[model samples]
Target: MRSIVFASGKGGVGKSTVTLNLGLTLAAAGKRVVVVDADLEMANIGILLGIDATPISLHNVLSGENEMQDAVYAGPNNMRYVPASLSPEKMERLDLDKLPSAIKKLDDSSDFVLIDCPPGLGPSAVAAIKSAKEIVIVSTPEPSALADALKVRALAERHGVKIVGVVLNMVLGDRSEIKKEDFETVMEVPIIGLLPEDVEVRRSAALQVPVIIRAPGTAFSRAMRLLASRLSGEKLAIQETKVKKGLFSSIMEFFGRIFGRK
Candidate 1:
C-alpha cells in the first residue's frame, strides 16, 4: 500500500477530516484503503464515521496485546479503520518500537494506508511521519495554521519523508481570487487542493459519510477528488469531471445555495 500520513502541527486544522475524505475518494475508485488513527490523544476519525471505539485499538496493537489485523473496523466505500484506545492514560504508554510492525501489516493488504496523526510534535506524530512514504499536510487558510503547517513541513523534510503536498482547508468564499502563486509562495509546497468552508463537510461527517461522496461536484469536492487522483498518479481532469453530471453535479447545487451561488 502507498503509505501517506495526514499531518498538521496545529490542532483544529482538519487533519482527520481531510485524511478520511481522501481515503473515501480513493476507495470509491476501487482502491483498498485503510485508515489508522495515530492521533492517540484525540482520536475522532471513528467518531466522525459513526464508529464506536472498541476495547481493542491502536494501543492494544502497539502493546502487542492483539494483532493489528484483529482491531481494524470495516467502514463504507470499502475503507477500513483502526481507532485509538479509549484509555488516554494507557495510550500515553504506547510502545513506539512496535508501531512499525503493525503499520506494515496494514500495508501488506491495502492499496493505501492513510494515517491520521495527532496534533503537535509528540512521539505519536513523529512515529507516523517516520512510517509514511509521503506526508500530506493539512492546514487552514488562517495565518496560525500556515505557521504550524510550515513547521510540520520542515519536520517531514528533516526526517527525509517525501512531502506529497499541502491541503488547504476552511477556505473562504470564492476561491477564484486566492491566487495559486500566493499560496505556493507562502507554503513553499505544491497546493494540492483547497477545500472551501462549507456546511456540507460537517454535515457529511454528521451523517457518517465522506464529503466527496455527498458533494462530489462542489469546488471543495472537486478539489478533494483531484487530490486523490493526483496521489494515484492520475492526471488532473477537473474540468471534464466538473462538466459531468450525477456524482460531481449533485453536491455543487447544495453548496451554491449556502454560499450565495458561488
Candidate 2:
C-alpha cells in the first residue's frame, strides 16, 4: 500500500479533518483506503466519526494486546479505519517502535493507508514519519502556522521522505492570510489543495460525517475530491457547486453583513 502521513506542526490546523475526508473520497473512488488515527493521546477521529466505543483500538495493537486487524472498523464511503484510544492509560503503554511493522502488515490488503499524525515533533509524530513513505503537510494561511509547517517539511526532508504536497485548509480569501505563491515559495513545496473556509465543514463535523459526504457539491468538498483523485493517479475534472448553507451559516453571514455596513 502507498502509506501517506498527514501531518502538521501545530494542532487545530485540520490535519485529521483532511486525512479522514481524503480517505473517504479515495474510498468513494473504489480505492481500498484505511485511515489510522496515529494521534494516541488526543484520538478524536473516532469521536469525529461518532464511533466513541471500540473494543480494540490502535492502543491495543501497539501494546501487543491485539492485532492491528482487530482494531479496524468500517467507516463511511466503504472506508476502513483503525482509531486510537483516548485513554491516558493506553497512551503510556504504546510501543512506538511497533508502528512501522504494524503499518507494513496493512500493505497486503490496502491500496492506500493514510496516517493521521499528531502535531509537533514528538515521539508519536516521529514514529509516523518513519512509517510513511510519503508525507502530506497540512497548514493554514496564517504566518505562525506556515512557519510551523516549514519545520515539519524540514523534518521530513531530514528523514528522506517524499512530500506529496501541502494542503492549505480553511482559506477565507482574506488579504490578511498568506497568498498561495508566498506559501509555496516559503515551504519550497507545491500546494496540492486549497480548501475553503466553508460552514458546511463545521456542520459535518458536528453531524459526525465527512464534509465530502455531507456537502459533496460545496467548494471545499470538491477540492477534497480533486485532491484525492490526484493522489490516486486519476485526473478528474471536479466542478465546484454552491454551498448549502445551514441556519448557523446564514446567521453568521447576516451578522457579518450588518457589521460591515458601519
Candidate 3:
C-alpha cells in the first residue's frame, strides 16, 4: 500500500477538499482508497463529507480507547475514511507520536492511504508527514501560497520523503498570478495538476459532495480525474473541457442578469 499525505504550509489552500475528491475519484476507479483526516485540531473532513457524528474517531485510536480499524467509516464512492474528532479536549490529549503505528495498520487493505494533513509545519502536520512515504503539496497560484508550498517541499526533502508532485489549485488565469513554469522552477517540483477557479467547486463544497461527482464534466472535475489517473499510474484519454466562465465572471453575470444588462 502506498501512503500519500496531502499537505500545505497554509490553510484554505483546499488541501482537505483535494484529498477528499481525489480519494473518491480513485475509489470509483476500483482502487481501495483510505483517506485519513490527520488534521487533529481542526478536523473538517467529516463535516465536508456530511458524515454523522461517530462514536469512534482518530481521537479514540490515539487515546487507546479503540483500534484504528474501529474508527474507519464508509464514505462517498465506497471509500473508507478515518475522521478526527472535533472536540478540543480530544485534540489536546492526542498522542501524535502514535500516528505512525496507526497509519501502518491501514496498509493491509488499502491501495492508497491518503492523509489530509493540517496546514503549516505544526506537530500534527509533521507527524502526518513522517507517517507517509510520499507527499503531494497543494497550493494556489498566489505568491504567498507558493511561498508556503516551497516551505512544505523543503520540509519533505529534509525528511527524505518522496514528493509525488505539486498541485496548483484555484488557477484564475490572471496575469498577476505566477506562471506555471516559474512556479515549477522555484519549487523544484513538477506540476502534476492545475485546477481552475470554477464555480462548481464552491457549489460542491456547499453541497458536501465532491465536484468530481457533483459536476463531473466541469473543468475542475476533469482536472481532478486526470490528476487521480496520473497518481494511480494510469494513462487516461481525457478530453479537454472548456471553462465557460470563471468564478468572478459567473458572479458578475449573475448580477447582470438581475439588472437586465447585456
Indicate the worst ten consecutive residues by lDDT in candidate 1: 239-248
**C-alpha lDDT values of all predictions:** 0.78, 0.86, 0.86
Error of 3 at 19 (Å): 0.3
For all predicted structures, in order, the TM-scores are: 0.83, 0.89, 0.89
Local error of candidate 3 at residue 260 (angstroms): 45
lDDT for predicted candidate 2 compared with the true structure: 0.86
Candidate 3 colliding pairs: none
In model 3, which regions exceed 4 Å deviation?
A: 236-262
TM-score computed on alpha carbons, candidate 1:
0.83
| lDDT (tens digit, per residue) of candidate 1 on 136-199 | 9988776677788889999999999999888888887455444555767987899888777878
**Residue range 111-196, candidate 2, lDDT tens digits:** 99999999999999999998899999999999999999999999999998899899999999899999999999999999999999
Task: Give the Cα error of residue 39 in candidate 1, in Å.
Answer: 0.5
Q: What is the C-alpha lDDT profile of model 3 across 1-262, one tens digit per residue?
A: 9999999999998999899988888888778989999999888787677555578999999888899999999976778999997667786567888999999999999999999999999888999999999999999998999999999999999888899999999999889999999999999899999989899988877765567776888998888998988898996444332223332234335335434566
**RMSD for each of the candidates:** 8.2, 8.1, 8.3
lDDT, candidate 2, residue 37?
95
**Clashes in each model (backbone N, CA, C under 3 Å)?**
1, 0, 0
